[model samples]
Target: MATDPIHQFQISRIVPIEVGSLDVSFTNSSLFMVATVAAVTLFLVLATRGRGLVPTRLQSMAEISYEFVANMLRDAAGTEGMRFFPLVFSLFMFVLFANLFGMFPYFFTVMSHLIVTFALAMLVIGTVVIYGFMRHGLKFLGLFVPHGVPGYLIPLVTVIEIISFLSRPISLSIRLFANMLAGHITLKVFAGFVVSLSALGAVGIGGAILPLAMTIALTALEFLVAFLQAYVFAVLTCMYLNDAIHPGH
Candidate 1:
């Protein structure tokens, strides 16, 4: 039987379990998340196990990833931001690996789900809120108060700023979720066309050529998008962390 394209996105329980009112069952999504984490951990551990003056390919790649995220944090939030390098780097690697892994056949796209992406977004914004208050105390409220505005306009501007600040997690989650969902759906539709058209006749087989070509092209584009989205997530994270560090203007 031809499987449904949408079925790829469905969350199925591998082991059903519950505690009180909460359904904390083992699921496909949960499995992929664990695999993603293990893959990243093993990649870094094995890559740097033999750190030497003459680095191997894995070592070089690890170093590049490290420097790339370090430079990103440095540029976005400055030297003080290096303190959060573990947080920023972990987020980048996790998202990047999750995105890339999802491109494989039969692998679940974790970030394609709204709940997963939303949780990640909330984790980021929550960190910003917690650290912002802890680091700057009540001064963190200054982030919502713009400088050099007229007294009469300050109230309106502050309200707008507060709304914008609150919308960060929503915007962040939606961007990742929508992009992944749309890209995968488009790819699936095109692929289905290839399969359906090939079954009709000789003419239909010839007609499938266009969709096949487009599918190939889209596959490449999706790879680029996967990397770009992960980078964007990490970059925005650094920018938000900057607010925690300098919560003014």
Candidate 2:
């Protein structure tokens, strides 16, 4: 299985646990998730521990990330959305670190899983719905009714809007999950090609060079994609939160 492109995505139980009929066994995916959280926590703690006037490299990074998300939220939802900063920031950092960690050999990419991404997308949508209703009550339904629409078209437009809103979570989750899954699989396939080709005689070694180079290029591209996906997720989240704050239009 060393050269199997799909083998890397396999989920294996690291610590199998059986609680009656329920299999809540801790798997490689679980381990990586915990690792991602721990890494983010450690980085933030260390980054802000000193609070120096002349910021350290870690502190600079932390500050930049903070400002980046802060500006994103502020611009999208205005100052009111800053209330959800912790949630947005946490999601961004978690996804980013998880994606970065997966770049390492043998690390499980939790973000590549549909269930995981769906859960996160649902969390954002849930927050929007819960907070929207809590703050605006029945009027929050105004989100489905566009302004200045003719009375006859209102019903049809409302139905369309409702459908579009409902699709948000599915699209959000699939976008992240699909991108990571496809990128990793492609990377693995190219890497596997390098290995399989190199295993042959001298001519095989020479031919392996192309795939090896491609693997390296794909590796760098994947890193860029990791950050972009996280950013897109966060930006979309801010826009959704804006809907909660201002449900009209």
Candidate 3:
């Protein structure tokens, strides 16, 4: 079980709770999710609490994260999008912290679950839809109609647009889930190879060097991926929110 690559993704119940027919059990996944949120909250609070004229390392990191998301949102959705800064910032931080937490040994990756990522994607799309209609009324449907399509092609274009819009959540969710799942599984397999090889003999120990190096390299790459996935998710979210703000485009 220790060498099983798939074993690492298992979600064992930490505190089983049954509410009638529903199982509201708190599992390792739930614990890690709570940890992720708490970590992000605590980091932000502690990092900015001092707010010194000369910023500390934590303060600088916090400030840089703020500005990075701010700039990305602004560029994608313009100044009006700043109103959604809280949402965008929260999503970015939550995802980033969650991904980073998964890099630790024995940690359960919440984002590795399709359901979790799908739920988050739905939240973004749901916000865009609800806000779009509430803010623009029926005009929100204009998002599916292009600005300069010929009359005969409008129907075809509209249909395509609608399909594309509906697929957003699926694509968004799968992208994050698949990347994290695949990366971790690959890493686990390579590391398992190293362990199994080392156990064989003196000859086997030398044979383990390649897999060990690969394990180290993959570890570094996964860290990079953890950050990039969060960034991509945030950027795409900003683009989607832009449709809500300006449906004509």
Model 3 earns a TM-score of 0.97
What TM value does model 1 have? 0.98
Summarize candidate 3's per-residue lDDT along 1-249 as a digit string, tens digits.
978888888889999999999998999999999999999999999999999999999999999999999999999999999999999999999999999999998888889999999999999999999999999999999999988889999999999999999999999999999999999999999999999999999989999999999999999999999999999999999999999999984
Clashes of 1: 0
Model 2: residue 118 alpha-carbon error in angstroms: 0.2
lDDT per residue as tens, model 2, 137-180: 99999999998999999999999999999999999999999999
Please give the CA lDDT of all the candidate structures.
0.93, 0.95, 0.96
RMSD of each: 1.0, 1.1, 1.1
Error of 2 at 225 (Å): 0.5
Residue pairs in clash, model 1: none
TM-score of each: 0.98, 0.97, 0.97
lDDT of 2 at 89: 100
